[model samples]
Target: MVRAAMESGELAQVAVDVTAEGTDKLFTYLVPRSLAGRLTPGQWVRVPFGGRRLVGLYVGPAERPPEGVALKEIAGLLPDIPPIPAPLVQLARWTADRYLSTFPAALRLLLPTEARRQEVRTLTITNYRLNVDDVEALVSELRRRAPRQAELLAYMARVGGEAERAQVLADLGESIAGPIRVALEKGWLTAGRVARRRDPFADEHVEPAPPPVLTPEQEQALASIRQELIAPPAFRQPVLVHGVTGSGKTELYLRAIALVREMGKNAICLVPEISLTPQMIQRFRARFGGDVAVLHSALSAGERFDEWQRIRRGEVSIVVGARSAVFAPFENVGLIIIDEEHEQSYKQEAPPPAYHAREVAAERARLEGALLVLGSATPALESFHLAQTGVYRLVSLGHRIDNRPLPPVTLVDMREELRAGNRSIFSRALVEALDQTLSAREQAILFLNRRGYNTFIMCRSCGGAIQCVHCAVALTYHLGDDHLACHYCGYTAPVPSVCPSCGSDKIRHLGAGTERVEQELQRLYPHVRVARMDVDTTRRKGAHAAILKRFADHEVDVLVGTQMITKGLDFPGVTLVGVVLADTSLNLPDFRAAERTFQLVTQVAGRAGRGDRPGRVIVQTYQPDHAALQAAAEHDYHRFFAEEIRFRQELDYPPFAHMIHLVISGEDEAAVAATAQNVHRVLAEGGFGGQILGPAPAPLAKLRGKYRYHLVLKGPDVRAMAAEVKACFAAARGKWRASRSVSLSVDVDPVSIL
Candidate 1:
């Protein structure tokens, strides 16, 4: 059968699933005539490769097989599926070329894992809707002969004339299935089936909300964005909406989406974190109702697949989710809004593409001739620089919505607190504010970037701290299980009672995390309800939404969390926000540390005083006088940008010069270090005029059992520098492949150097 199929003249260009460097290209395969029309480009198909059947994307009809090469027949066609939208295919290609990622890796972005296979177990509603006229008579007759049947009929009637069989069983128990069977047999209830989606949020309840009256500032911003939406289908500049925190940026986004929808076009709204998706989606769903579809990492595979299909079918006009939602299948996208655009979370750190969603969204909008709106309390330097250079239009909302005041921030010097004999994690001002907020029946939020119970465990006798064996980082102490775990490598071990290096038992857990702060809050305010929102606490699906919902309903008086709770969350009841440690991220080796610190402080501060009452923030830091903290405390963005941009310019980082970060890693330290130096030499010898730095050990010198080294190239033009770097990498590819242990990865426009 295979020989006969191969002889047939049907051929397809298939993008195999393998993601290795050399194996990223498309291969020609013989397609059976029966599956020719059925299998379209962008549809998943099974193909024989290397003696195994691998799932691959059918990339379109192939021209012809190579001259003397054997063409293997396609193994099978994947189930009922639509071709991935053409725009997405182009975007994926663009992403692959620009980010130095494999085409297959970028293709995987559009195809969810569950969607590779056809058919899913969807729940169908079987059982009748009430025959209203005969219901009373049938019930009257059946009540005498069978009480269970009568009871089933009565229960069905109470549930609004229709119910799924599963719902019926759940409400009445399995024993009631017998009565339901009898009722169906007697024609008392009809049997039917309706396919139901395996929705992850099926258990979650969301109430539709009417759009609010836009503030004057928001109205002006929305009008500008709407104008862009209706503009000519040519290359248009992006619009940067530099709104202050609590300035109704979201309201502007909502109104812009409405305008786009009115034009019969779709929109993609992106938040930076999964924790922010539920609230953002809820808000979008409330305004747009059924027009909203969600995409994020936390969703179950089936839920993601169903949502992707719905989007492709044009069942939804709006997509709201984390970074990946930027690739949503919208045939005619009219608007692309990226909320909290400055966040580093928008950059994919783990994989080859390392693409930034904001960058992708900008290009996508450009290709679709859609209006791109970037909203942020702290915009990235590169984005704001573009606005300043007239490449993007800039709009600003200087005041909070409803004329609410920006929260007054107080920076406490923890050094002073220590000298004054106060050693608690919370400053006196923060404690007092918490007391006042709780007394007023209002809510508060305590933020710490760190998670786990303690930062690290150290023995006072030997001054030795416990660290992860695999990674260069310290092991964090988790509270409940009394174990130490590495955040970078997932390495875990039981906490040592004594220092491993010394024979003394004077070990103590130091530094406060969300867990420690949570424990402290409970101890300090025993009667107040508190909730913790962090990766550990919110690992389960819908946990972010659940925790925020509880806080919104005033079920939680204090919400303690990591950076996840910082952006795009609004709660009028939250009157006070406490920064347990403001200097945690200030001292990282990365140059963007100050920018990140300023953004976090400003963003979390914005979360307060969003309600009717004025809000307050207390920032406790060992270095209260630092420029970033001071600028954040004063709510002075311009000042911070001015100072930070100067330093960035002087240091030749980001806006001043484009950067490409190269990392070489392997189990053998010598091989990895040697490979990194060799690659640097290749670039230098290629006459690339860019400033080359590193071949230095990475901040995380060792991670997940691999020795790591880093190199950076900085140049005035990103495109030119990228081309040169690509050429240099190509020139050295052979040597790298021949080497036994080293591997190289490149990240262009890297978010962080460390």
Candidate 2:
């Protein structure tokens, strides 16, 4: 009976690893008897389908083979690879269904490039010892027909026995891809998996940083987290750590992480951006030493793979990184900490399964029985509301560490500055403060959300603004390059000496940016060294960390940058912070604009007065009396929350209701508009009670040559509304399937409508 069963083959249901929608459904395949018990649910396998081999995740046993067709046998099991944890697989499925994404896309979030592709064969040098005499003959013969292959052999021989095929191809150029293939066919190289060595910090020397003593407020917060940790498994409430900037929230996080680690459990710490990862990793490494593993988008694929391996092998007890780190493969996670939890960077804005790290962290903690801590100076409105509703516990760190006072902020109305005949971008007060700080040799930070030298150029004659030819936005004028570049599309052109419109020579570069601010600093204080940190200066790998490290070492007297500089920085010598334009983000076309503005102001202010010297801030804004700026200046989060929550409730935004932002886009504007109308009509016919607003043009109506139209659905019940929205979309998709010219995305709990 056993032999007959084995010969008949055991059937297994597998989710084929393909990222297309509607292709994520399960298919049954025969698992050879030899690998029957070895293959488990969540294990990766190669299966033959439609006359080709494809990787798939083994879901579970199938009840029976298909009614008509004979089942294809699984080709092979990926060797030495452990099954993905069942909980994560379940989580991925839930994320897919909730986010209107394919299961494979969700799985991609959990498994990065290396882990997913690790099972595939990689080309490596064959077993030819370089010290042997046969190498000369092989090289000579190769040089005759394939010079590139010969050169590759020579390079490899000089380097060592083996190297990654991709690395070699990348180094030599894609022209060598054919040579590599030839080498393998000629038996000069072997195709196999080779261990990749990736060390992102290989060149930099890292020192051990000693943990600071916890302040009383920090200790109190840690105690609350501990109580939750000791509660019944998976039932502990999430804790919202509402601390003021410089209030020792990091210390609380470290102490909590330490406690969890000491109990023989792992922890995951998530920051919001790649820019923050370096500083956060430095602190974590200092406390946890080699036991910490870092993950973020900035790391090379090999580095990320190595980090994942380190985690899987139990070589690290703590993982610190950006949003994706929440998916770290830790079997016994005891704690999860999300720093700067209010950051929009935590939300995945593209490529589906647009899951927020906070949401995932909360769910993961609940599933793993881990204590989840969300630390933020300005908690998200929804999160704070949850705390108020007793769904999450709230803890506060109201004061700065070591009795340091919050920096005093003065709002300088730029309108007032202009009236006083101070036509400079910097207000008189800010200029005076900068001069004083420079003279005293104390550091300062100038923050301007915009990056280039000028926000936009306008003609004095025609009142027309210089704009990107492709995009709807204005072109920013960069100083050094003397070019007008589109911030959205990367389109660049030489700055017109005369206005392109109306042929007027009176072109005015209007708006301040970090580049302009840095240039102005240089003009004002020629003797003081100035460093700029922005997208322009920090595009290269490790540039962010390098610039920050130099600034931390006091290499520059003043640092000018964008929102990247506002958070996760702890430089004591920095006594002054200047907001070049406080109203920059306040005027953005989004509901959370005020919330974002307040958070940026409060966070940047925290950077000041962190050290022994009392700090001061100069906020230059056109709207000084704006509630966001007012609340931030007074450092009154409660007041801001109350005011903002009222607006949110009245406007039917999150915390009071749910929103689904649907964007329809296509190369043809008419087609896009038509599809959007169809979707809207479908939703209305479905009897969805949600308020559906606009088949209107999106803010970026035309981007990358695609015309966009937007529709927003708001209601109290998101789950039911989501189902209705999904069904409506399905009907629209089916109707539009023949041409397939139009496409749409569904963003639930969208951070921005634009």
TM, every model: 0.92, 0.88
- lDDT of each candidate versus the true structure: 0.84, 0.84
Q: For candidate 1, what is the total of clashing residue pairs?
A: 0
Off-target runs (Cα >4 Å) in candidate 2 are: 1-6, 48-52, 117-197, 203-210, 274-277, 497-504, 731-733, 736-739
Candidate 1 Cα lDDT to native? 0.84
Model 1, span 312-345: residue lDDT tens: 8899888888888998877999999998898888
Best by TM-score: 1
User: Per-residue lDDT for 252-344 in model 2, tens only?
Assistant: 888899899889999999987844647777777777778888898888776787787678778889998888888887789999999989899
Alpha-carbon RMSD to native, per candidate: 3.3, 7.1
The CA lDDT at 626 in model 1 is 93
